[model samples]
Target chain A: MPQISQLPEFYVSQIFWMLVFFGLTFLVVGRGMVPRVLSTIADRTTRIAEDLAAAEHARTAAEAEAEAWAETEAAQRARAHDLIASAKHTAALATQANLATATARIDAQVSAAQARITAARDASLGEIEWVAADVAQDIAQRVAGLTISADDARAAVKGAFTHG
Target chain B: MHQFQIEKLFGADWAIAGHSIAFTNSALWMALSTLLLIVFVAGGLQRQVVPGRWQMAVEGFTGFIDGMLAANIGPNGKKYVPYIFSLFMFILFANFIGLVPLGLIGLHPFTFTSHFSATGVLSVMTFLIVLIVGFAKHKLHFFSLFVPHGTPALMVVPIFFIELISFLMRPFSLGLRLFVAMMAGHVLLEVLSSFVISGGNAGPLLFAVAGLPSFVLMVGICALEILVSGIQAYVFVLLTCVYLNDAENLH
Candidate 1:
């Protein structure tokens, strides 16, 4: 049709304009506009990455602080446990010392009571021996109508008492 | 048929350095498309940390191209983004603008892509770039592109000739695909619209009966054309990328 037949006449002009317009579009869009769009995308990605990194850093710091506090608490608890154990040990030692002193005092009181009892028995025995000797001498003089010596009666009484 | 007519808007039959430089409807639309693209892209150059809607749209388009280049051409293809982006934006805008029925307002909406001359130039430019890049990267080895690595020596001559012809046809095929598709779609729309108008002139009753079906079919075709427009643009750029890859990698 005319589009095919008039190619020689129109082709040059079409190509000419095509070059002009196409070249302008290429320069303005490719060189001017595209880079801006690309940069905007790059900026957004960078900001997101930065925010994530900051959050991770904050989390790490918080974890470290918690760990440190836990360590301190553990150390203090161990110290308190040591103090309690030492107090218990000292109380036991003091109770043992007090018990030994009380037992020694009770033993002394018992020995003193036994000594007094022995003294009272010895005095009664002496009195009984003297009475017996007198009685024996009198009986001999009355019944037998003989003069018996006092020393002899006493010896005989003493021997009888010893044998009984 | 009248939609495809090229009329001079300004500048009397002019030429510069023995070259005709008349400003025609085709040139005006091309300029308009370029202007709109500039405004669209430049308007969103806010560099906001969180992009607004306009910025998001612009960035989305850029990312689409970036991903395409990365997938097809690898990292080295990034440098050619400007050229490829320009082609995509120009063709896309030209296609969409052509769909507007400015004739309802007594204004001509000339689609540059419907013209073979325009698409031919574009395809040739792309092919030239491929050649330049191929030679620059591979030097004398670029000629080895026609030679299959594991072919019988006896069949090499015939295969080489076929490969050479295929290689030479790249530009014609690329250009013709876009031009023919665009021209055919617009011509169909023009014909269907004229039919509706002529049917109405017959009588109101006949218009209602005949025009309705034509109108519905035109609407369907319009939707198809829109799809084709987008696909053609994508195909053009995708083929460019593939050619570039071949140039760079020699495959």
Candidate 2:
């Protein structure tokens, strides 16, 4: 084969070029490129880890804030309930006092009105009795030609009202 | 033989001392392979956190080599990643580039690995590294690689010599395997192609008998050639790692 016969002729040239090319290959691939690729991968991993940590931190803070807000809301709710209860109690007391005062005033006014009505009725009855007595005296003098004094006529009328 | 013939690219051979050093077809292919390798390596060096396809492919190869070295040589293998990575990719690219049938387009695809001179240099390089690592790391204990573990005292000496011979043969064996496989495959294709041509020139019956079957076989072998290229590249790197393991670990 020409490969055997021609070995002495070409081996040096082949080896020379090979070493030159492969040596450069090693430099570019190993020295130049690999470190950069590895670094990039490392950077990504770090960034991802940091991002995850931040997310966890934010979540924890949010949970704590929510807890604080709940406590405040609960406290506010209790305070509002207490205020409402006290206000309701005060309103009830005021209403009771107003109702009692109104009832007492109304009672006094009614009693005064009752007293006036009783006095008016008594005055009307007295006038009516006097008018009846005068009528009786005049009738006795005209019909019987009897001389009758006003006092005696009154007494006779009273005796007749009392006897019936 | 014609495929294997080397000619002067400059119409003259460059000689150093008494040896003829010519820029030949083999040198041209070597340069082409290296150029493409640079492009491939450069394409993948985008250095983005999330890699593009080119970068991913580059990572995939590097990762594959890293894993292999880690498996074979273990913890101390980290330092050899670049060298091993280059070796694997160089072989893989050369093997694959050769199998590309550029002949159909009136161009010859030369497999430089098929040349013993080229394969020999690569094997010697791997062998030298193994020697250096073996000596550097384990010192004199690296000599224990010659004898298998658990041998009887009586058989130790003989086993050592035999193992030593095989160990010595490693570089040549490595070179020979690749050179023969690549050279033989190309030669076979050329021979079969010749048959198809002769059959076609003869008559329809001969064409149907020889050309057709040979054509079918060529197609089948073309597929197999693609497979072999990958496998051979894998085997070469695997053996390198194994040899390195012996040197590194003294097993």
Candidate 3:
């Protein structure tokens, strides 16, 4: 039953306030909030990317260090083996040289001892020959009891030797 | 003076305290709208995935809301999905409900007091709720939201005061937009429909002539109203989100 004539005058003011409300809301929403949220998102993404990159770098470096260590250990092992082989070789050569020197010294001493023995044996043989001659001459003189002259003895020895 | 022909759509017996309320048809339409919204949403929810026609409609609404949040609030804006979604759905439901043609029976019951209609009450209530939500979220920053950044010291104090006044005006703007649109549509429809009054001898002929234009206009307006209803609902929610954004971010 409400008539148009009774309509309130507040409608005009209502419309005005509506426009004001819209303007302020738009300002607050668009300029103030959106940019901050967008920036935060960008920052978070960038940080994640940086973290991932750092992790990758660390991984690669560790791998390289491990490879280098393995290579160095391999080279050290080879060098140690070579050192052991070379030491054994030197030891073997020294032992051979020492054995040769010892043998040579023994040979020289044996030669000197053989020379001394030959000399001593000849001196004894000479002494023994002299004694044998003296005995034989004494025995012959006693048995025959003949003391003939020297010249006669000489001539008889020569004559007997020619006849026999 | 010409005698006023009192043409009542309901029988002459239909009255509220010996005066006609014209509420019967409007009430029926309102109830029908509410029922349709519930049925559609419930049926859609039940399907959940692998949606049928009804379910697809609901999913479309949800997906659209998701896209809006992601675009406006960023990918992390998914956090506020439920709040935004509920705001959108409720308004959408209310607007769609307004479109049902229950003749003169569709006016809301609870919103009606001794003086004002329920539709008007709903608009004001919705507006206040949005304002409070914004305030609760931002607190002090909500007040700062109106003042533009990078103002000079001389300009700052005046601008701050103006901003404060403007900030206080939000609920009025939000509620009136919806209320005006709805009230205008309904009043226009009612006036047009009244022209096809059934009077004794001239009823049929008069009804035919007036009914054609009225029906055509009503149909055209109805279609437009459907679109307006949906759009208004979206706008309401969009503004709410914008307010929420201001409060939280302070810019």
Question: Candidates' TM-scores?
Answer: 0.78, 0.76, 0.46
Candidate 3 lDDT over residue span B110-131, tens digit each: 1011112323333454456546
Better of 1 and 3 by lDDT: 1
Interface RMSD of each: 1.3, 1.7, 13.5
Against the reference, the lDDT scores of all candidates come to 0.86, 0.84, 0.55
Candidate 2 CAPRI-style tier: acceptable
Q: Which candidate is the best by lDDT?
A: 1
lDDT of 1 by residue, B5-97 (tens): 777777647876676868889999999999999998887788888789998888887778878999998999888877888888789889989
RMSD of each: 6.2, 4.7, 16.2
lDDT of 3 by residue, A49-102 (tens): 899999999999999999999999999999999999999999999999999999
For candidate 1, the lDDT comes to 0.86
Top of the candidates by TM-score: 1
DockQ of candidates 1 onward, in order? 0.47, 0.42, 0.01
Model 1: residues with Cα > 4 Å off, grouped in runs: A50-164, B204-209
